[model samples]
Target chain A: MAVLTLAQALNQGLEQALAEHPEVVILGEDVGRTGGVFRITDGLQRRFGPERVVDTPVAESGIVGMAFGMAVGGMRPVVEIQFMGFSYPAFDQIVNHVARIRNRSRHRFTAPMVIRMPYGGGIGAAEHHSESTETIYVHTPGLKVVVPSRPADAKGLLASAVEDPDPVIFLEPIRLYRAVRETVPEDPHTVPIGEASIEREGTDVTLVSYGAMMKETRQAAEVLAERGVSAEVVDLRTLVPLDTDRLLASVEKTGRVVVVHEAPRTLGFGAEVAALVAERALYSLQAPPKRVTGWDTVVPLKKSEQYYLPSVGRIVAAAEETLTA
Target chain B: MLQLLTPSGDVLGEPPLSVDLTRRLYRAMVYVRTFDRKCAALQKQGRLATYAPFEGQEAAQVGSAAPLDPEDWMVASYRDAAAMWMQGYPWELLIAWRTGDERGGRPPEHVSVLPPSITVGGHMLHAVGLAWSARHFGEERIAITYFGDGATSEGDFHEAMNLAAVYGLGVVFFCQNNQYAISMPRTAQTRSETIAEKAIAYGMPGVQVDGNDLFAVFTATAEAIDRARAGDGPTLIEAVTYRLGPHTTSDDPSRYREESEVEQWRRRDPLERVRIFLSERDAWTPEWQERLETEASTEIERAVELAEGMDGLGPARIFEAMFDELPPHLVDQRAEALRSVGQ
Candidate 1:
């Protein structure tokens, strides 16, 4: 095991996947020489050669559509679309072809591909770069949406995504790329998709979140513990194949729930979690479920970006509301 | 224009394949034409859903697809059923798809054809990707994509061509410029002299052929396919043709086009010219014509029966096919879909 950042873990993970699976090829803009803008794919082109790690033209739809065909043509392609906001150009391809191929061909011709993008705000990045639109993919049928919170999970979940039979939207938390450093296994390992991890153990209330929000959720849990109130933090790694069992168990035990995300409030991922809690665990709930999310507005420019993202104070305040209720 | 046969059934250049292969091509074109007419008739009779007839463009579809190896890939659009069938998509499944059955989209194992792309230009990139995969893996196979002239207006068409040429991907962009995309005439689609000329912008060779002549379309497609297999890079072929029938079952040709124009195309019918070409060479006969029609009738009837006779798409079917394995949420939704129908 070696201590690594989330970005390093992902780079090593992709390197490992390339070394093992000859069919696995990386396609995206600047993925070759530049190693991607954020350096998430850094040093991959040199190690794996330009053939395997392709540097594609700057067309989102072209990158994804070509990747989809490559997947159908019997190669496992992983595409990077730079940022979440830029993914809109290829949204039609993802929704129509990449997601529909498996169903359209009746499992005969499947697009076993992965579309990776660094998402969420608070990086003070330029326009269209800091947008948390993971919910759009979550709402799309046939597309498996996943998010990683830590280094080990990022590496392992990526491994699982590469080998999956269906298309997976691997949403990397941009803010957490170098936010935390931890020791990850050197040998190959996979954190299976579709399962949630309980980051902290408690009983008073459950903090439900995924991706970048996990950091703030964990901080809220610490604050609650120091205040003598126990709080459990639930990190939902896979949003599509959601770990409902773990989510319900945590809610049923605590009986008070607070869902947090950087995306907007209306129909955000938190809405689904909140609705599920109300539907299946209504009776088990001692307090009504609360959602701490960004406002229903365009994620503003980098200026005043702090006002837009879900802050640690906002998460703690929402958790306190659930506790008081 | 690159052509091997004139509009009057006169051989102009060397035949792309042997006479025996030419006979087979004629038989397949006749069969697909019969099937196409039957689908339109069925749609009129309310037996099938809306039908996109490929009557006038038979040579363009069949001829281009005839040269592909079975292992090669084909990404076609809704109006290219003849091309899709030639590439191994079964008649029954194509018919089933027209009848609105998802099961019809599934081709048998070993058929490398994708379900016909309904979107205008979206599927062209799929051909680019298939070609990329083939080249990346050091495979000799190539991908041929079929799209209409109207599909050329879509941004994806540009991207596909540019990327394919840039990467030296083995692919054939076969555009059947059949004079119109629904009510919009081909002249309104683009200002370029011809769809084939657009390939020049992408740094690839482009060839326009008489789409009505089976030998002409076949020869052009064969040359492009050869170039692709030899790793000479992608090529775009524009088959100039006109559709005799309306775009689909719901269309009215008289409202937008001239009847005299349609009559002119009738004289240049792809099937009749081939029949003339074969008959003058003593390969066609009255007895053979009767047998071809009878066999076509039988084949189409059987496919129609198979398509109409399938079991109803129950709740399980609706839920299935989305993913290899159902996630927890889908499992619950499937149960709910079943319960809603009281199953």
Candidate 2:
């Protein structure tokens, strides 16, 4: 086993998927020769050749629309959206066509494609570079949304996304690209979509989150431990088709919950999580579930983004609200 | 033979019809005419949902659909039941949809026709996609997609045209320009002089034909299909027809279009033109004319009974056909819905 960063894990995962499935092809801006803007596709072009690792023009709609055709043409396309913000241009194809194809055709046709987008805030980038718009994809019916918090999970989940019969929106946390190092096994296996992982076991309060927010959630859990609060940390791997059973089971064990995410507080994925807890495990809860999230505003540029993104302190405070109640 | 008769309902120059082909074409056209009328009446009586009548457009649909090889795929919009029927979609399926059943017109597997697209320009893109697939898979089958003048306003139309042109895929873009979109006249639809010329922008040949003339519609479409099969890329055919009825039975043409415009188009009515062509040529005798009406009415009655007798579907059907292979979660969701409803 060798230690690899999340970006490196993604590259290895794609390489494996292409080698495994003859139908799988990688296409995106800079993905061919330059190995993607973040270098997540580094060395893939040389390894797979330009035909399989295609570098596309900067037209987001064309890229997505063509991929839709290619998917219908029996190619398992893994299309990369250069950045999360740049993906808005292709949102129409993604939401209207890719997400709804199965339901619209009533299953006459299925889109076995993966749309990869680097998401979430940090790296001191300018506006639109860092935003968690996972909720938008999650809200769309007939789409499977998956995000990985660690290097191994990223590799495993991506392989599964590529193989999934339905189209999958694969969100990669940009902040965590080069942040962590872990051994991503070769001949990597798949992780089931919509399942949550329990990062740390505890009973005092459930500190729930996913993607970039998981970093802060882990930090907050550590701080809570020092303050004599045993926080149970649950990392949601996929937003859509959420592993509600795991979430409810955890919330039931702790009897209290604090959900966090970098996306805006209003109508965020966290709100869905909170609602699920209220509906399934309401009587088991000792106090109301608290939500720690970003302000309901556009993701500001580097200057005030720190203030905009949720922090460990904010999560800890939210968890403490359940404690006090 | 491209067409054995002319639009005035006459046996045309050079080609003498054996009794069989003439009888078939006449019967098909009559059935479509009656079907269009019945749809209008059903909509008026509230027995059927909204309808897109092909009353004056019978020749356009019948002529174009006649020559299609059975294996060739068809992609159509809200109208075009005549073309769809000629391509072998059961007439009962169309009736089911008009009568408010959702499963109506859901394609039978292996029939090669996609369900009718309700959104104006939606299925045009799928047509391009399916054509691309056929070309990639080395399948010789051609895809013929139908849309209207109003569909040109949608972005998907432009995208589809550009894609089909660049790919040189086996696709026929058939635009039935029926003079108006609801109440909005063609003048208000586009700045281009003719819808056919729009094909020039995509670098494809475009042909404008009198949609009321079956011979012209068939000959032009057959030539386009031949070109597409030979790998010459797509052709845009603008069938310049007129809708003789309200946009739907629910619409009142007097509100937006003048009665004079309607009267002028009625004078050029496609059915009458074909009847005249056949009568003047001595092909439509009083005896053959009686048989055509009787045969078409009997066929319509059989389809109506079959559609009315089909089994009723439940909500589970909504979730059932959504995938070729059902995903585990959706299977659970379907089961949950069934249990909740106490089924």
Candidate 3:
């Protein structure tokens, strides 16, 4: 085992994938010489050679569309779209082609590829730099959406995403890229695509979140524990093909739930989680499900970003509301 | 600008192809023309859905495809049935696709052709990627993508071109400039004069060919394929032709184009030129034409029957292809679908 940051773990995961599968390749803007704008792919091009780790022209649609064809042509391409905001240019390819190829061809052709983008907001950045748009991918059928909270999960989930037979949209939290370190396993590992991991087990209320927001939710859980309100923290690793079984079990145990996300509250992934709990575990719930989320407006710039994003206090208050009810 | 055969049954110079090869090309054009007419008739009879006819563009499709290795990848739009068929996509599957069956989209594993892309311009990049994959795997295979004049106007066309040129990927951008994109004329589509010239901005060699002449298309595509196989990157071949028919079965050409223009193109028909060339060489006889038509008609009839004979696919089959294994939500949705159908 080795202590590694989320970025390092992701690099290691990509390295392992490249080594294990001859068909696996990595392509993105600045992924070659610059080692990616975030340096997550640092030295990957030198290690894997230019053929496997390619630096494509600045065309998001071509990057994704070409990867889709490569996948069909028997290559497992892991593509990176510099940031979440830049992924929109490739949205048509993702929604229209990547998500539909398998269903359209009736299993004759499949796009076994992964599109990774650094998402969410925390570090001061310009407009269009920080955005939480996982809900759009989650809503599209025939795609698996994955998010990882820790370094170890990032590696394992990325490996799984690369090996999956269907297209996967792997969203990396921009803020969490270098935020934390953990002893990640050196050997190859896979975190299944549709499973949820319970970060902390409590009986009073469930604080559900994933990706960057997990840090705030974890903090909220600690504060609630200090206040004598035991809270369970469920990090939903995959949004699409949601682990409803795990979610319902957690809700049934706690009998109260507060879903949290950095995306806007209206029609966000939080709404899906809240609705799932209401539909399946409503009778077991001691109180109505609550949501702690970013406001239903564009994520603000650096100065007012804190006001727009869900904070630790917001999560704690939501959990407290569930506990009181 | 290259021409081996003129529109009036005369050779421009020494024929680039042998008499036997010219006769074969003529026959293939006749066969595809029969298939195109049959599809149009079927669509009119309500037996098939919207059909994109490639009647005037047969030479561009067949000639470009003739030089391709069977293993080469082909990504084409809705109208290039002739090209796809030449690349080993079965005619039955093509008909089945037009009949709205998903099974039609599933080409045989040996065939490297993708399903016809309904959306314009997006699939060109896919061809680039496939060729890139081939290069990565140390395979000598090349990829070719087919689209029309209107497709060049899409932003994806520029992206695909730049990527292919930058990476030196083995691909051929086969754009059949068939004059109109639905109701929009070629003149209205772009002011660049010719689509081939667009390759200049991307730093790739481009060629303009007489699309109605079979020998020119065959020679140009052959050269392009050789360059790609030699790792010379990609070439953009713009086959300038006219759409003799409507954009599709649902479209009426009279709305935007003059009948006089259509009449002029008819005089330069892709098939008639080849037929004239074959006749001048005494390779086209009445008996031979009769036998070829009978064979092509029978083959098409069988394919249509096969396409129409399959049992309707159910909701279970519809749900099966979405993923290797169904998730809980899809399982629930599939159950609901089954219940609704009284299955």
Candidate 4:
């Protein structure tokens, strides 16, 4: 095992996947020679050869649509969108074609592919660079949406996403790319696609979050512990096939819940988590479930991004409300 | 423009096809025409859902598909059922699809045709991908995608064209310029004089053919397929044709087009020109024509029977096909769906 950043872990996972499967191909804009804008695909083309690591034209829809076709043609393609902001052009292909091919063909054909995109805020970048829109993908059926918060989970979850039999939207937290490092297994491993990971176990309240927000959530758990309140921190690695059992179990044990996310508050994934708790484990609640989320507005530029993101302070306040109630 | 046979069945030059091949082409067109008419009738009888009739574009579909190797891939739009069938997609499957069953989309493995894409222009990129994969695997196989005049207006068409040209992928962009995109006329679709010319912008060879002339379409498609297999890259062929019937069973062509124009196109019907050419060459007989029609009718009848006999797919299939192995959330949802249906 070696300590690696999330980007390095993802690169290793891709390299491993390419080495293991001849049918697995990587295609996207600048994913080859330039090693991708984020360099997540660095040195992949050199190692795997140009055939396996393809650099496509700057066409998001074409990248996805062609990948869909390749998947249908019996190739396991991993397509990369440079950023979450640039993925809109391919949304039609993703929603209309990629998501429905299996159902449209009645199981006779399946698109076993992965679309990787770097998501979430905190980096001082251009207008479209910082955005967390996992909710859109989670809302679409026939797609498995996965977001990993740590280096180890990034590596394991990416491996699992690549091997999944259906199309998967692999959302990588842009902020966590180099911020955190962990000992990742040298041998390829998979964190199951539909299960949640318990980062810290506690009894006072459950703090549910995924992707980049897990960082602040973990910090909030530490702050709550200082106040003599044990806070359970849950990292939902996969958003679409949510680990409702684990979520319910945590909420049941604590009898209080606070969901956190960086996306808008109106219809964010947090609302779904809150609803699930309300529907199945309402009697176990010590107080009404609370959510700490970004406001319903476009993710602002760097200077104002702090106000837009769910802060550790906000998570602590939400946790306090759930505890005191 | 390429033309081996004129509109009035007159030989414009030396015929490139032998008498036997000409007869086969005529027979294929006749079969497709018969199938198209039968599908229209079925829709009227409520046996099938809305049907897109390729009545006048038979030669365009058959001629283009005739040149493809049986193992080659075909990605066609809703109006290209004739092309799909010509590429080995079963008539029964086509009928079943029009009956709105998902099972109909599942063609046998040996048939390389994808289910007809209902959306405009999206399948073109799929053809490019299939061809690119074939080339990557060092296979000689090529893919041909069929769309209409209206589809060229879609952004996907441009993207597919650019990618096919840039990658030098083994694919043929077969556009049957049938003068209309549903209610929109070709004039409204693009300002360009011809769809074939658009390929020039992508740095590929482009040609317009007499879509009504079997010999011209077959010859052009054959050459394009040969060039693709030779690793020379993609070719775009625009078969200038017309739609003789309404776009679909639900459409009313009278609302958007004039009958005089329809009457004018009817005179240049794809099948009639071939029929006249065959008769003039003494290659066709009245008895043979009658026998061909009877055989086509009988085959279509058997297919309809087979399609109608199969039971509707169970609701479980809805959840089953979405993923290779259904996840827990879907498992719960499936159970809820089953309970709601009193299953």
Give the poorly placed runs of model 2, Cα more than 4 Å off. Answer: A25-75, A84-97, A123-131, B1-26, B278-282, B321-342
Error in Å for residue A36 of model 4: 1.0
Determine which window of 10 residues in candidate 2 chain A has minimal summed lDDT: A101-110
**lDDT per model, in order?**
0.91, 0.81, 0.92, 0.92
Taking the tens digit of each residue's C-alpha lDDT, what string does model 4 give over B281-304?
888888999999999999999999
CA displacement after TM-score superposition, residue A239 of candidate 2 (Å): 1.8
DockQ of every predicted complex: 0.86, 0.34, 0.83, 0.78
For model 3 the TM-score comes to 0.98
Better of 2 and 4 by TM-score: 4
Displacement of residue B302 (Cα, Å) in model 2 is 2.7
The local lDDT score (0 to 100) that residue A306 gets in candidate 4 is 88
lDDT of 2 at A149: 86
Residue A220 CA displacement from its true place in model 3, Å: 0.6
Candidate 4 Cα lDDT to native: 0.92
Q: Against the true chain A, what TM-score does chain A of candidate 4 give?
A: 0.99
B166-196, model 2: which lDDT tens digit per residue? 7687789999999889999999999999999
Cα DockQ of the candidate 2 complex: 0.34
Best by lDDT: 3
lDDT of model 2 at position B224: 91
lDDT of 4 by residue, A1-325 (tens): 9999999999999999999989999999999998999999999999998889999999999989888888888899999999999999899889988998888888777889999999989998899998898899999998999999999999999899888889999999999999999999999999989999989999999999999989999999999999999999999999978899999999999999999999998889989998999999999999999989999999989888888998899999999998778
Q: lDDT tens digits, residues B157-206, model 3?
A: 99999999998999999999999999998899999988999999999999
